[model samples]
Target: MSLDLGMTNAPGSTPRAPGRLGVPVSAAEALRYLTDLGMWLDERRKQLDAIDQAALSAPDQSDREALTHDITVSMALWKAISDRYELLRVTFDSGRVGPVQAEQLSTLIWGRLDVAPGDGREATRARMPSGAESNLAVSLPEACRLSDAMSSSLRARLALETTGLDVSIRVKGIRESVERIRDQVSMMPLGATRDRTQRELIALEQRLFDVTERAKRGADVGGFLGPLEVEVAARERDLIVAASRRHESERDAARARELITALAARGDAIRGLQAQCLAAVTPAPKLAVPDVRALGAVPDDPDAIDALLARLGLVGKALDQAHETYARALGERDELQGLLGALDAQVAGSPAVTAAERADLKPMRDQLAAVLAATPVPLVRARALMAAYQSYVRTVTNNGRAPL
Candidate 1:
């Protein structure tokens, strides 16, 4: 009898019979079963190695851990397969079966135990579980084995069918749903509201455009004739005032130059008189007048005495004239310095000059003014008359040589 157990049905649905439990064993069958088990083990080992390689090449720590978990699960599945194979080996060896008969017997035993159907169906379901319940129930080792078997079965099934039928059905359903949604959306009043909003936006844009155009025109007018006009007018007024002040400064400088020249001339005359007085006080060289008794007796006469007194009187008059000249020159120098001071005061008091300039000129003017004010009137007038005489001479010389 043959057992056809399908795991899709509930457990104990099929009746258990004795003959269907095991088949006659052969050595060839046993060897074949062992060979198949060995191949499965080798494949599982290769799969574990691949998982290890994936873990090594993983991009992040989390991915490496996931790949290592997969390798551990594959190793577990390999161990399970080895256990099942050993159980089959024990059954076959006790029955004294040939290798070929052992392989058949093993297949029957596995079938009777309902292990083969459970493994194959669970393997397929494990690959792509129905829902969260199947996912929770399957171990990682079982999932790895199921995934390999189900993927191979799916590929074979797909190869036997016509192309693109499943995709066409999905595409049709999607198209219908999309069309229904589009029709419902088209029936909405959103299009009218959108049009109204667009019109309002256009009106606002037009107003903004007009305002920007007016602003551009205002900017152009301001650029052409704003602060620049005021600046130019102010600069022109400043230039005129500066020119007037410059003319006044030039006149003042000329007056100062004339006063300095007069003072220098007077100083020279004073220095010359001082030099003359110093020379008069110096001792003259002595002459030797020995062994001339008659010449010495003639010098004691009255006529010689009267002539010597007249010569001394003339020397005294010349000395008095030189002193008068020095005093007059000094007085004249003080008067000129006073005039320079007055001119400086006028410049300083002018509104055109700044406060700092006035402060600088004021001290110099005060010093010269004090000296001139302290001088005696008679001396000052005499010095003034002398300056007038010098000025007349300079004027005449500038006019070229003439009869005096």
Candidate 2:
């Protein structure tokens, strides 16, 4: 005799008692249960179509009602089957469910919870099943589908900042999280804690991936991401800040480019100025400016150019010293003239200077004027005049400070 192990009603009004099948042994066995149910749905769909064909032929109200109710129930069961199988598939991907555990779970959810939804309270309660039912909900495709908004939005936001910032690390994190979710984690023999831990980890990874995609989308994210949610949220915040910084970063880059270009031009200024300044002094054929090769071949990247610019500054300082030397060598006559004129003005205006000190300054001033008047004044004579002027100033200063 056929064993009366269990019974199941048809999708809708067909309340036929059913006999039980043997409990599944492996994950494959569990999959077969879903596959078999899918095949049953196909048959039920045909049954539904046939009922539709009959109603078209005869137009009976009761037949139409039965057809409509059957349609509703068929659609409902199809959705339930799809959802349940997808959950198992997700769980399997995460290394949570092995063969034996999958079979047991198939019995628990499909074989148990998917009973006749006749009573309203029972049907309502079935929709939100607790205890054993909730365990498998996170692995479903709907969970993944629900998270698409965040990932998609985050991807868009990150794309904008790519021109400004190195988002590679974050992008890699997101990609890896997504890949980990898709990858099959280590499938081991069915155990209790291992599955749960793996499940939570994989779920967290998936949730993080979802969180990234959801960034800037502003949609409600649905999943238990655990402590990883903090990471996801932090990453999302980072992406936002990175994106906001992009415009200003680009602007700063443009300014840096201008500065780099200007620094590069300093090479020519340095060479030219060195030549001009060294012309009047000990005329070296070529003054030594340290090789700042990159200045002439400046990089467009601001940070790269900054190092080269610092070298340019050293060259610039040498240029300054060369210019000062040239000024002293070439303008020595003007220098002596200015010293004589200053002394004349100081002697004319001062109360501290005695007549003898003033008379002494006149001869020094006259000597300085004679040196200044000489055309192409010898460099040695110019040097002697400078020393004489400084000595005269010191004497006058001392005489002013001392009692008359």
| Number of the predicted model whose lDDT against the real structure is largest | 2
Off by over 4 Å in 2: 1-223, 241-249, 261-273, 282-293, 296-333, 337-378, 385-404
Tell me how candidate 2 scores on lDDT.
0.44
Q: After TM-score superposition, what is the CA distance of residue 17 in candidate 1 from its true location, in Å?
A: 22
Tens digit per residue, CA lDDT, model 1, 1-404: 11121111211111111123256545654556466555655655554454445446556887555334323433444455556557666766755766565555545434411111122213432221211111122222222233333222221222211232243332232233223223323433456644553454354335434434554565432222212222222222222222223333444445444533544454455456555433322221121211111112223323454443444445445445555754455545555666554455545344554666556545554554454454332344434443543343333333344412
Q: How far is candidate 2 from the true structure (C-alpha RMSD, Å)?
A: 28.6
- Cα RMSD (Å) between model 1 and the true structure? 53.8
For TM-score, the strongest prediction is 2
lDDT of 2 by residue, 1-404 (tens): 11111112211111111223234435544455445544544544444344334434544666554334323332344455455656555554544566566565545442422322222223442221111221122222222221221222222322211233223344444454444333322322246634764665566566666666775376533222223433443333222222223333455556555655654466566666556545443333344654445446545443555555566667667656655655555565456567667666766766766789778777777776766666545557656876876676666665536411
Q: What is the lDDT of residue 340 in candidate 2?
A: 67
